[model samples]
Target: MATSNQGYIASELARNDFQNTYDLLVRACASHPERMAFSCGDSHLSFAELARQADALARYLRHGLGLQPGDRLALQLPNSLQYPIATFAALQAGLVLVNTNPQYTAAEARHQFRDSGARAILVLDRLLPLVRAVQADTAIEHILLTSVDDMENPRYDGDEPGTQRFMQALRIGAELPPVEPVAGLERLALLQYTGGTTGVSKGAMLSHYNLLANIIQTLELFGKPGLLEPATDVRIAPLPLYHIMAFATNCLGSVGMGLHTVLIRDGRNLDEIIEAMLRHPFTLLTGINTLFVGLMNHPRFGEVDFSHLKWVTAGGAALNDEVARRWKQLTGAPIREGFGLTETSPVVTTSTSISPHRDGYIGLPLIETELRTVDDDGHDVAPEQPGELWVRGPQVMQGYWQRPEDSAQALTADGWLKTGDIAVLDAEGFVKIVDRKKDMILVSGFNVYPNEIEDTVMCHPGVRECVAIGVPDARKGEAVKLYVSLKDTALDAEALIAHCRQFLTGYKVPSFVEVLDDLPKSSVGKLLRRELRDRARAEVG
Candidate 1:
């Protein structure tokens, strides 16, 4: 498949026929009824069972709880069987899904639910305290709760007063009449909120068509019959499903392809993750650079087998070429890197192979995806020049919910979504990310990208994790500052700077290097450059 200014989709790729995401689910169930659909903690749910349970819960939400079409339902749970079931059920019930991070604090939870105007929420039982603190601040009327073992061993009890067990909902919902389908595929299906690193998180309104398009585009690479083979390949799902990458790929795309997904309860639990890898001769993997680095650094990483591994997918952050090289070297499977954001249904471009990926470039846009790199004047930049990446596709969100001004600034009248990432198209037509537009450093009138500095730092065997941010500089206007956590204590900041000098230019080298116990990261393991930048500014003040 190739891209150009003409047809948005590559001529080689054919659009699949489907009503929407729900339709995709129904088809998967019908085709692979007896196949294992999901598994966690020695428990397995087949396609037939998943469909049955989701239908039951959907009926309960529609009739049993008096929920109506277009009502928003928040899903605030970790990676578990209940998450998939409840999400599909909510879809069948014609309720919009608000995928909430289970790690969210009360304040963050309040912002999402209140902003979405969610009427109901499905939460993990242990995390009910956050719900209690935020429920009063939201429009939440129905509370559905579940435990880690709710599917394996049903739990009927909770401390919260107005809550019901998720297992109980399944049992009751099983007896209700089948839920009717929502009228339009263009209707809103999900309210995926941004990470709020730069500012307040705004919900990007995604419709059923939006989701379906993303699923189809991604599936062209993952689904069909061979790549991520249905009912055969066991995929290791470590990233939180709430994140659009995991949500669109693992939760929907993988499962819709009829693959068995093993959810990692906590991505930080390297022991459990490695054990899961050993338990299932997993054929597929999905993760960001942080997750990949963590796994390979684990003491028992070499113990887990990669014999059955077909390939690995990386996204959610810039993939360090060094990290990709190491991962491929260790696993014997090449890492195909991709790039996207929450606004674009999370996938704007993906690599169909590892050729261009090893060069530290994000691959071509998905089928029918149009990309333009423009300067401040909205004019296209020359090849090998850096500019803001603008995207237009079926997968792009309609707009940020209820924020017309912010939405207007993000999207163009002609439909391009302004991705604030500075990128360049190499002579080979490969796209390489320079850095986030906000994180670019200006040193003596030269633009400096943190990703380059960080990638260079990560090449060091001593470094475990690192981030680069622009800090106040009296001489240069702004300087590059790097914060790192080390795997080798013998390595020091001075040594790191010296190492960077070997690869990076004088201006691009980090002016300041600080080694700490650990660097800050988001719940999904993406580095928090915004947090580091704020702290540096405060320190200067």
Candidate 2:
């Protein structure tokens, strides 16, 4: 028998609760073959259809495309029926899935493809040009393209050179011999890239066991009233599949739980998201502070029936107290906030229905998870003291892809993954995130590294030097604000912002641009981001 103690699961239970992800998928299919597994727009796929399609695509990827076991496959498609189809198929084909941001620029996509040495990619038809632009710089050999209209129409119409329609590939795959599931859960499953503290992007090498453990941990905490059980719940997936939060929850966890997840391709469109919610009346809803606020503010938001919403979980960014309170006030459902990183399979601590929602605290650690706060000297900090948060669990990532040095720096010798966020642990074992040790800006629950933003801004010939910092934003929680020292005095803020937009994603682009004589710097000539942030706050005040 195992008992919960101090927000940690018993050691015996932790060691024995082991299941391979692929095995779990097979079990799910066997248990509920006809259960609706996924929904995107008007197209829905049952567990049987998903299994068949994935196997077909897996066969095509292995035999048709010559993709060998352990080969990396980049999935740059948005949230849709095709995403899960490609994801499970790649796993079945014994390929490492590289979860790439669909909104990434050509340069951003190139760096990931080059670093991972991906042999193949599945991208949206509209984004085919982006892949082609970066094709010369990477080892990509095969391109599988899908369109928004592909699922409903079942068409094979495409004229791209050296590329084939994804639907057609699936058809061909169904005729070929079935690909067997890869053995062993220790094999690499995903290369989920995240912005590093050192300002470079690194892929977190997550194995099948890591993801499986996390899914189990999440279910142990949140599994109640069959919220995730097959054919019992409908979960609204407004988050992108590429992100770790949504990846672990909707794409992997919910599937095993037998949940019918409605995928939203473009979550940014508030109207479309609202319409989907109205149509589905989902029981499980997950989002960040921004989305919760945006929906509550929408004119037609009050029209939707939220009586069916079982829970609303917020992650990827800090939850504002006001936002949480407002959501509860409106929907009678408290917003349960959790915390995690890309390295930990993206789930560490989450507030369950059994726990009380304390302001600013991220709640207890999941089952089989251990967390502690350590001072700069690596000594454990006392309760109520803020320090660097360290985590140890089966869900923790193996390491960064091909970067031993970075991996060594992030993980301790004894195996604790050093989470860069500052946190405080209470006597009750509940965790509260105080602040981020790194200067990464989280805009609308998306990581917008300041270094990446400043680098792109400096590329403008008119900018001599620039500094990017996160400023408090009403809607996004925090937004990027850039200050520039101009090479050409006539260079205006509008032009520089436009230049950044060309390279950065929509959220990474600066909301406010200010022209300054020179940026504040330390005696050694390092830009003082703290000083700029303080000045911005003072000006705002």
Candidate 3:
């Protein structure tokens, strides 16, 4: 296995036999039918059982819903057994899966549905109103809603009705007709949206080959065989499923290895998570810097048992030195940070789980991924020099869905994905992210693109122009701060903040709103975010 300082080259792990993601899942299921595949709370499913359910769901989609393989199906659910089942089922049925944040507003939901050309949606009942609001304007032909406790052990008050309905759907057993398998590795399997250079969320077209290749590369890195027993090795998954990090690491990675995944449905439920950790003795825990920091600062964090812990992987944002030190002290395990974008099937380079280096560096590239830091002119830079990181590997996404021009801009002529992240490749091949080339803010591991905030704020009657910049913060690693020039003097900072809360998610809402007579701009009238960021830093200092 040829490896790099970053880890392993993805080219070495890339398989020519597997055509798509569905084929990979089918292969895994066939090879490990009796292995434990998934767990959500007390509910568990074996590989055989999961495969059956996926086949059943695929049948329902084809026969009952009349959805074709290429049709898009949006999934708005948390981390659960159903998520994987639905995802694989969609792939098996030859449909493209579009993942949406369950907490998205009607506006956000509508934009994604319209952009992805989603013909159907499988969502949670709690988020039905948001979907309904957007469904009218979307190409959505069918809506399937699930209850919160659908797969829980004991029947809560919420479980009975939806479970009964779901059971009825299963009992009907609609025979699905045979569907042809499309082996276009470059064809889209997922429409993963990210806040692009322009700030508007654009779908990254991840083909079946892209996703499957990532899974293969990831599994090769693990080098572990057999199911990870729940009694011995459990994985803590507090992150949301919508994010590619959680999707790849927790959902797909866990399933591929037959590892038991304990889903923290709500990350805010810190006490419950700690308690569960104490009870289950989780060996591997993965999350962002803020999550680990919050846990270490929690009053009861000291009481939790970390004796059985083996590995902790952090990503989605930069890991602070202080946070990493405190986490290591509390858990007796170093928090290994990594670098990746949603466009790269999420995992490009990660630190070793067995022998982690505690120097705040995202360890080596995986088996078949290539990492190179390039200067402004696309020339490779020297080691330790900060430049835009260019990744070339199987994990890289195919292109942006329906946006050929955007795709052309993102991918280099030599097939490398131009990750707009400023990073340095050390002498040993370890990659350390220094900054972002794009104006994007990381709030609690969520990507809050400046353009999204600017657009939302500009809609306010009082706001003339606004610039959103990331400001250094002690807790969240970075906070969203808005510098706005008001059209009406009567529009105050407090009022603007209040208005934004209605339109944006809590993380996307700016923590600090500064009222200004004018915003800094270039000669061409482009908002200068760097100037605002510098001004904010100077003021804080």
Q: Which ten residues in a row have the lowest lDDT in candidate 2?
A: 1-10
Q: At residue 205, what lDDT does model 1 achieve?
A: 93
RMSD (Å) of each candidate, 1 decimal:
10.5, 2.5, 3.6
Report, for every candidate in turn, its global Cα lDDT versus the true structure. 0.80, 0.86, 0.78
lDDT of 1 by residue, 1-541 (tens): 2354444333322344454467767888778789998888778888788888889999999988999989999998888888888878887777999999776656668888999999999988888887988788899999998888787788866666889888888888888888866656688999998733343668999988888778767766554444655656899998788878888888887666788999988766878899999899898888876678778889999998898888888877556677788888998988888888888887988874433353677887776787888999999998888999888888899998888988998999999988888998766567888867766565533446677677778999999999888876643456788999999999988999999877665766898888889888889988888889989989998
- Give the clash count for each candidate: 2, 1, 14
Error of 3 at 310 (Å): 0.8
Clash pairs, model 2 backbone: 230-258
Who wins the TM-score comparison? 2
TM-score of each: 0.80, 0.95, 0.91
Instruction: Give the poorly placed runs of model 2, Cα more than 4 Å off.
Output: 1-20, 224-230
User: Where in model 3 is the C-alpha error above 4 Å?
Assistant: 1-17, 23-34, 153-167, 174-185, 224-231, 355-358, 523-525
Q: How far is candidate 1 from the true structure (C-alpha RMSD, Å)?
A: 10.5
What lDDT would candidate 2 get against the real structure? 0.86
